[model samples]
Every structure is written in C-alpha cells, then in structure tokens.
Target: MKLIIRWLLLACALVLLTQLDSGIQIRSFGSAMWAAFVIGLLNAFVRPLLILFTLPVTVLTMGLFLFVINALTFQMASHLLEGFQVQGFWHALLGSVLYSVCSLVIDVALERLLGPRFMPPPQ
Candidate 1:
C-alpha cells in the first residue's frame, strides 16, 4: 500500500538525515523506522493541538513560532525513544527542520509516482 511505502521511505530518510547531521543520531535502520512512525504519530495527534495553543505567538511571529513547536515535538520524540537522539535544543530545531524537508520530498515524490489514483479530482 501507499502508506507502507511512505513509512519505509520516511524511515530511510531518517537514516539519511542522521548521516547528514552529527547532532541527529539514529542507532539503526530499525530504530529509524520506529522514530519515523513516532514522529508521524506526534505530528498527526499532538502537533495540531500545540499549534492551536500557540496560535497567538505564532501569529505574532508571522508563523515563525511553528518552528519552535516543531522543535518541541522533535525533542519530545527524542525523549520518548532510546535509539533516536537529538543532542540539544538547537540540534532539535535543526533536526526537525531537516526531517520536515525530507518528509516533504518523500510526500511529493509519492504523490507524483502514485499519480491520479491517490489524488482527488479538481472541483
């Protein structure tokens, strides 16, 4: 399924991220997979709540505060997982930004490869 493929690709991206950033350390491929899943779940369930609560600051900062929220979630993920470690606040912020970039690339690639079946028709 598309979901499974996307998860695997994201995990691979995590592995790649670790290679690209010294601050972000992933123990193994399996650990990367779990980290990816946890990150996805946090983004799905927790990120929106945090965004809503921080809306005033986020608006005041012209949406820049979302990066802080993302870093918090990234740090939370590191705390929750043994194999995935982000060194410090700065590392967390950088890692989160990198991970988000990787995720975006994966999503766009998937959408392109999967084509119209996974996309809704224009209104």
Candidate 2:
C-alpha cells in the first residue's frame, strides 16, 4: 500500500541521514520505521495547524518560517521517539531538509521506475 511505501522511504531516508551526519543517530531499522511513522503523523496533523496559526509570520518571512516549523517538528519527533536523535536545532534543521530532499528524490525515482499504477489516488 501507499502508506507502507512511504514509511519505508522515510526509514531509508533516516538511514541515509545517519550515514551522512554524525549528529543524527538512528539505533535500528525498526526504530527508524517507528520514528518515520510518528513524524509522518505529526507532519500530517500538527504541521498544517502550526502553519495556519503562523501564516502571518510565514508570509512575513517569505516562507522561510516553514523551515523553522519543520525543524521544530523534527525536534519534537526526536524527543518523542527512542533510539532516534537529532543533536540540536541546527542539526534538526539540516536533518529535516536532508530527509525531505532524500524522500522526494526517492519518491520520484520510484514513481518513474514503478509507473503510475503504484501512485496513491489524489485527495
């Protein structure tokens, strides 16, 4: 299912991030998967509300504030999950950016490889 693929991609992204940065640590594949699921849930539910409430600041910053919001979510995930760690605000920010980029790239590659049949239905 689409959700399973997303979780796997996120876990892969986390593993890649751990390899790239010493500040980000993931203890195991299972831990990474759990962290991915939690982060996905937070991003799905909390991030939108945060963005809506911070719309003025987000606009004032020309969307830059979203990165800060992402970092906060990343930090929150780190705190809520065991065996997954983001060292500091800077690390969280960088790790979040990296994770997003990696996820996007992987998604695109997978889509191209697997074709449209595997894509989730539009909302």
Candidate 3:
C-alpha cells in the first residue's frame, strides 16, 4: 500500500541522513523506521499546532521561521524516540533540511513512476 511505501522511503531517508551526518544517529533500520513513523505523526499533529502558535513570528519572517519550527520538531522526535539522536540545534536544522529534500525527491519520483494515482492532487 501507499502508506507502507511512504514509510519505507522515510526510513531510507533517515538511514541516508545518518550516513551523511555524524551528529545524527540511528541504531538500526528498525529504529529508523520507527523514528520515521514518529516523525511523520509529530509533523502531522504537532507541526500545525506549533505553526499556529508561532504565526506572528512566522508571518514577520515571511515564513522563514518554519525552518526553526521544523528543526524543533525534528529535535523533539529525537528526544521521544529511542536509538535515534540529534546532536545539537545546528545538526537538527541540517537534518531537517536534508529530510525534507530527500522526502520530496522520493515522493516526486514515486509519483512519476506510479502515475497520478500515487500522489494526491495538489491543492
């Protein structure tokens, strides 16, 4: 199913991130997968709330404050999950950027390969 594929891609992205960043670590693929799921849930539920609360700053910064929000969410995920670590704020920022880029690329590739059915219509 699409959900499983998305989860696997996210796990792969996390694994790739660990290899690229010494400050980010994952104990195993299983841990990476779990971290990916947690991260997704956090992004889905917590990110919107954080954005809502930070609207003033986000608006003042022309939305650039979203980077900080994303990094904080990523760091929070590291704290909540076992066997996954983000060393510092800088690392968390870089890891969040990397995660977004990788996930975007993978999703685009899947959409292309699987046709329109693989991706939802853009709003």
Candidate 4:
C-alpha cells in the first residue's frame, strides 16, 4: 500500500514538473505512471552499474558525478517511452534533479504518515 502510494505521488510530481517548464513533458497520467516506474527500475538496476563504472570520477568529484548518472538514467527512461519527452541532456539533468527532490519529499512525507514500519532497516 505504501509503495503504491509513493508511486502515484511520484507520477503526480512528474506531471507537476512538466508545468514548471522543466523541459520534461508527459502526455497523460498513465504516461507519467509508466515514466515513474521506468525511472524506478533504472534507478534500481542501472544506477548501481553506473555508479560502479564511474566510481573513480565519483570519488574525484566527491559524489557530484552521481547527479550526471541520475540524469543519464532519466534520459534513458525518456528514450524508452513515447509519451514521456525530455528536450535534451540538460533537460534530463534538470528533470532528474527535480524528480530526486520530489521523491525525497514524498518519502519523508510517507515516513511521517506511515511510520517507520514501512521504511527500510538502518544500514
């Protein structure tokens, strides 16, 4: 239930991002949902690989390069979908930043609402 709620909220955030002229456009709620799901999958699967491959750069940049990895994941999602459009690399970079911020806010809100039971155990 919490997962579903988070997913829907993230989709809504994506829609709101399009309104901000973030250069990311979503054709419909369904598309936004798909985009959110794709992004999640990419983050779960691709992001780790990217981080590993760019470990040296990430270390050199003191983790700032993670933002570029996030942008690449965002752009990859846009390319895989028809209704989700990102203007270019820069647009993806901005969209990824916004999306990450929104997701963090949503997670915090959910944590407060649902309690720690739904959150992961501390590493």
Candidate 5:
C-alpha cells in the first residue's frame, strides 16, 4: 500500500519533470510508474556502489562528481527502459536535476499529508 503511494508520487514527479522543459519524457502513466520503480532500484543499489567506487574522485572534486554520477545513472535508466528517452548528456543532467527537485518536493508533501504510516521512513 505504502509502496504503491510512493510509486504514484514518483510518477507525479516524472510528470512534473517533463513539464519543467527537461528532455525526460514518459510516454504513459505505466511507463512513468515503471521508470520510477527502476530509478528507485538503481538509486538504492547501483548508486551506492558507484559512490563507493568514485569516492576518491568525489573527494577530489568536493562532491561535484556525485552530480555526474546522478546524471549518468539517469541516462542509464533511460537507456534500459522503453518509452523513456533522454536526448543527450546535457539533457540527462537537466533531467536529473529536475527529477531530484521534483521528487524531493513530492515526497515531502506526501509525507506531510499521509504521515509516516503511508510513507516509509527515509533510508
């Protein structure tokens, strides 16, 4: 139940990102939902690994490398999923920024409205 709501929120975030003039497109609600799930999974599993592997560079760059990693991950997810397309690296970077901001806003609103019972505590 909570998972479903979170997915819905993420879908909304994707829609909002599309509206932000970012080159992130989701052809349908189903695609958006699936892409959200895939992005969540990638962020949970792959992101940490990438962060760990790039720790030295991350440190050297004063955390700027994380933004690059985030954009790359977004592009990778776009590549893996059908019906979701991000044009180029710049587009992916813009999409990543939009996605992050929109998701954060949506998550906060959902948390406040639904409370912790409907939203899992942040990991």
Candidate 6:
C-alpha cells in the first residue's frame, strides 16, 4: 500500500542519514526501519498537537519553532527505538534537517518513477 512505500522510503532516508553523519547511528536495518515508521507516525499524529499547543511561540518565532519541534520529535523517535541513537539537541536538529531533505528527495524521486498515485492521500 501507499503507507508501506512511504515507510520504505523513510527507512532508506534514515539509512542514508546514518551513513552521512556520525552523530546519528542505527545498529541494524530493522531498527532503522522501525525508527522511520515511528518517526513518521509521531510526525503525523503528535507533531500537529505539539504545533497547536506551541502556536503562540511558533507565530512569535515566525515558524522557526517548528524546527525545534521537529528536533524534539526526532529525539523522541530515537528514544523510542532500540539501536537508534541521536546524540544531543544539535545532533537531533541536524538529523531532522537531514531527514527532511533526504525524505523530500526520496519522495520526489519515487513520485516521478511511480507516479503520484503511490503517494498517500492528502490529510
């Protein structure tokens, strides 16, 4: 299904990130894959609530606070997943940026190759 494809791409992105940066580490592909899934889930579900709660701060910061939220979510995912570790706030922030870029690249490539039909329905 579309969800599975997205998760696979996320897993690939995470694997690529771990290889690119020493601050992020995944001991096994399975753990990386699971971490990707959990991260995606947290972003999809928990992140919005966080954004809403921090709306004032987000607006005050002109949306820059979202980066902090993203980093926190990345750290939360790392904590939830065994064999996946993010060193600190800086590492988490870097990892979040890297993950976003990698995921966007992977998604764009997959969309071009497989067509837009594989994408999840817009929420």
Per-residue lDDT tens digits of candidate 3, residues 1-123? Answer: 666898899999999999899999999999999999999999999999999999999999999999999999999999998889999999999999999999899888877776666457678
RMSD, model 6, all Cα superposed? 3.7
Cα-based lDDT for every prediction: 0.90, 0.89, 0.93, 0.95, 0.85, 0.89
Candidate 1 per-residue lDDT, tens place, 27-74, comes to 999998999899999999999999999999999999999999999999
Over 4 Å off, model 2: 117-123
Clashes of 6: 0
lDDT of 2 at 19: 91
**Which of the predicted structures, 4 or 6, would earn the higher lDDT when compared with the native?**
4
Backbone clashes in model 1, listed as residue pairs: none
* Candidate 6 off by > 4 Å: 118-123
lDDT of 6 by residue, 37-74 (tens): 89989999999999999999999999999999999999
Tens-place lDDT digits, model 4, residues 6-122: 999999999999998658999999999999999999999999999999999999999999999999999999999999999999999999999999999999999898887545757
TM-score of each: 0.92, 0.89, 0.92, 0.93, 0.87, 0.89
Model 1: weakest 10-residue lDDT segment is 114-123
Q: What lDDT score goes with residue 70 in model 3? A: 96
Pull out the clashing pairs in model 5: none
**Model 5, range 18-42, lDDT digits (tens) per residue?**
8875577889988888889888989
RMSD of each: 2.7, 3.3, 3.4, 3.4, 3.8, 3.7
Using TM-score as the yardstick, the better of models 5 and 6 is 6
